[model samples]
Target: MHDLIAAPFRNEHLVLRPGSQRAVKIGAAKFTDLENAVKAGRALPGWLVDVARRAWGVDTFDRPAHAAVLVRRPGPYEFSRATWELNLGCDFDCEHCYLAEKRFEGLDWAGKARLLHVMRDAGVVWLQITGGEPLIDPQFPAAYQLAHELGMQVELLSNGSQLGKPRMLELLAALPPTKMSLSVYGASPETYDGLTRRRGAFKRFTRGLDAAVAAGLNIDLSLIITNRNAHEADAMRAWADRLGVARREYANISPTIHGGAETLPSQSPEHLTQRAPFTGCPAGHTFFHADPFGRASICKVGREPNIDLPTEGVAGLARLGSIADSLMLRTGGCTGCQLSDTCRVCRPMAKVFQEAKAPLKNYCQHG
Candidate 1:
């Protein structure tokens, strides 16, 4: 019921509002003061009440701390962000999808609710709910509502196929996500439908996109460029520009997460740009990913040695940092390559490419 959330982020304390971008950093004393006020059922402090009204337009002037704020207890685990795949089933079957098998399997509603709680306890604040198409999942509404109610800033990643539906639009309009990231496949229906291998798919996507924009929901576009739709790349960019929404293009296609070569042929070789060198990442140190079944991994690209959140709970995450360090070691095909300075792919991704038996040209500078 509360709109405000106060939580520990790494070593600092932060006050965040769901569906808003503003974050206020408070000192340790103010955090403890808020905790005491909530414990005693006292009204919020004057500064915090003013911050509430100014930041999110919520007036907590005379409101008790517990009534207006959900204070997240500090946890030993330091993760602050996570991505959850609601389901693997999608309305459109894109050829370049990373999931090799899009079998519709996931945790049931009860399990999903419990997993969200586990995430909260692990100190997650920014949550991305994705899927083969998350909007198509049956329990998406309930699960998304629960995430919001738990004081997590939710971001929805979808193909924009279901956004046209009245109920879907209504739910999002009522409890808006931080952003709706919709993937744009092609500029024309013929190209779009052909690429997704689903007839009438482009029409449905356009409808959903228009509806979302009209509803005043925050949206960003992921322009997916593949060999099938590479010719329409300019058109896609122009369309996104015309819409005046945030847009980014993805030209690199990777092997499926299962290390299958089925999706590699869709890569547009001409459009394949060199990625920046693999600098260090904060995958396990600051963030992690969760599959539909509550399995947690360092990130989407590195799935091995993951922990089952449903069974192991938050304590299971303690090993991820170590797992990440082991996964990043230069091993196998990458051992003694001498091109470590210019390596574009991380070790986990390189290992996936090796498993897929993809051509060295696809992922290595050695080619």
Candidate 2:
């Protein structure tokens, strides 16, 4: 059931195409799959599958599988997932934040709701709510509830600070997100405070994580590697293991949103080994980001060919495709680069932050 709800999140161009007698297609750029007999498909039957309005009732049946009359539309496709920044204000002041020093100006409740409706109309069914700290937004509940009512999968991106509060936990329990992605700073209080410059962030994060876990919410915990806390990598993993939640590690950093080289901890050679990229990053194609004020961009740093969310027509989406395609050209540093095979960095990223020089960062060990 979650698979069908999560399909949109996995694919930007996910669409319902008619196939064979009664099969439907779940498509991404480089991947496509067929589904039939969805209700009897999985052992875990979720509310999303039963209540799914957009893709449900197309040809669902009680048969085993492959027993429906399916059809496909002609060529054009639209986005399936959207990342909306409800607010830029955060309670934490991390040194490596890409959106550093941004203010908290956003549309009011009514206007924000309208933007969500637009996304739904345009075929976006997976809605990712993110922020410097999305929990800080006063209108977060309204936005979250609206996504649920629209039958979109709601994912919350947070730093896990305010989530520990009693009121916040109650609200989350009432209307849980499809999933929550919370960033973990360090393994202990001392290192966490050193990196985030907050007094008791580790405590808050742990408490918040416990609250969410206790409430039976799916959680994904992430750790961003920096010079200050790289030594705690193993410890961090063990801590997540104790909590029994999924953990991820991040060793990459990009320039600030306005192209400023914000103050970041100096890294040791160990953190940089083999971190360059061989392919372009996904900004316009797989998914796109939109800031609080409705300024839409392919990614956070590569905000080129930006369009306002409200006025983003077919032309706006087309511009995103053009910008993304331009980055794939085999020119200059991209051609015959020694780091091509092992590099995880992208072209537009290099151009924006590094003058397309110095290999994104000093993290590459390729000779």
Candidate 3:
């Protein structure tokens, strides 16, 4: 059974068999072998055959054993983390805003509560609150309180527009350690405002940053590096410096894949072919996104119908569990890609842009 399952990769020097439940000496060290053992003149067990197929990268097996051995097996769930989008709408109209055409709607109190309960019960420890600007939602404060009450660490992805407002300030003052990630497109108002397509947005963003910093909030910066502003990396670094922050606090890169098709130039298949090493996407495994429609997705872009989150539930825990399983099984394009560590090509994002054949325009190689 083991040999049949591993026929394709038999030359890879991977062996599978069963023996006493003791450590097998492979080289200088002893390692415990957990595969099924072979009995005297007996057929392998069916269960062991299945294990060989999954653990040894074999596609087929007819027999089973009590134990087996192989050169490779599934790795531990290292990226077993999760991130949630608190809201979908954003206040700015940046040129690269992926969901630019989507309506700027906010979730209601009941919806927020239901979602929170679902996340809490699902053992999701990391939560991110985002929106057209989360502060726009009056219930946002209560949402934060609920997340804290449920023992989940929260992060805020905001444009910093309303941070300086009196009510928003009061809300910030009452919250616990919520990390704030602010988007800084350019160093100057002209560049930043032009990209956001809003006049005076730069002033509002800076004011909010100052207010958050003065209030002793944990803040980080996110930058969307684009052809228009790639040259400003050093200047943007200088801005972070003046703010008494580290350069690593900033995330600057262009959009390789935009959710809104009308917002950017089309990319060809040749352009979409990734030149860098393919790192496995850890979406369903480490992170997940729930759209306003209540659809759960792996990495905010996966579109396979069966892999998508069910929309019936508010918290989407079942969807999360399914996603985790799908990730473990390596059932999508992720399983075919070799770049599982260095590439940021998210399955969800790729699924969204698959029809368009968009090139990996985002930060493909980390600088």
Q: Which candidate is the best by lDDT?
A: 1
TM-score of each: 0.96, 0.74, 0.63
Question: For model 3, what is the alpha-carbon lDDT of residue 128?
Answer: 71
- Which ranges of candidate 1 are over 4 A from the true structure? 57-62
Q: Best TM-score goes to which candidate?
A: 1
lDDT of 2 by residue, 1-367 (tens): 1223323433343332211011234344322233333334532223323333345463243332223212121112456667999999887888888787958889888778777776665556667899879988889877877776555667888988877888888877776676788998788899998888889888888888888889877788887788888899889889889989988877766566665665334343476556534645656875677778766777766676677767664346656777767765545556777656666656665554554234334433342
For each candidate in the order shown, give its overall lDDT on alpha carbons: 0.91, 0.65, 0.54
Stretches of candidate 2 off by over 4 Å are: 1-76, 264-268, 273-277, 280-282, 313-315, 327-343, 356-367
TM-score sort, best first: 1, 2, 3
lDDT per residue for candidate 1 within 1-367, as digits (tens), equals: 7768898888899998877778999999999999998999998888898887887788645568888889987657889999999998988889999997798999999899999999988889999999889889989999999998888999999999999899999999999889899999999999999999999999999999999999988899999999999999999999989989999999989999989989999999999988899998888877999999999999999988899998899999999999999999999989998999889999999999999999998889988
lDDT of 2 at 293: 75
- Name the regions of candidate 3 deviating beyond 4 angstroms: 1-81, 248-276, 303-316, 319-347, 359-367
Number of residue pairs clashing in candidate 3, backbone atoms closer than 3 angstroms, sequence gap of 3 or more or interchain: 31
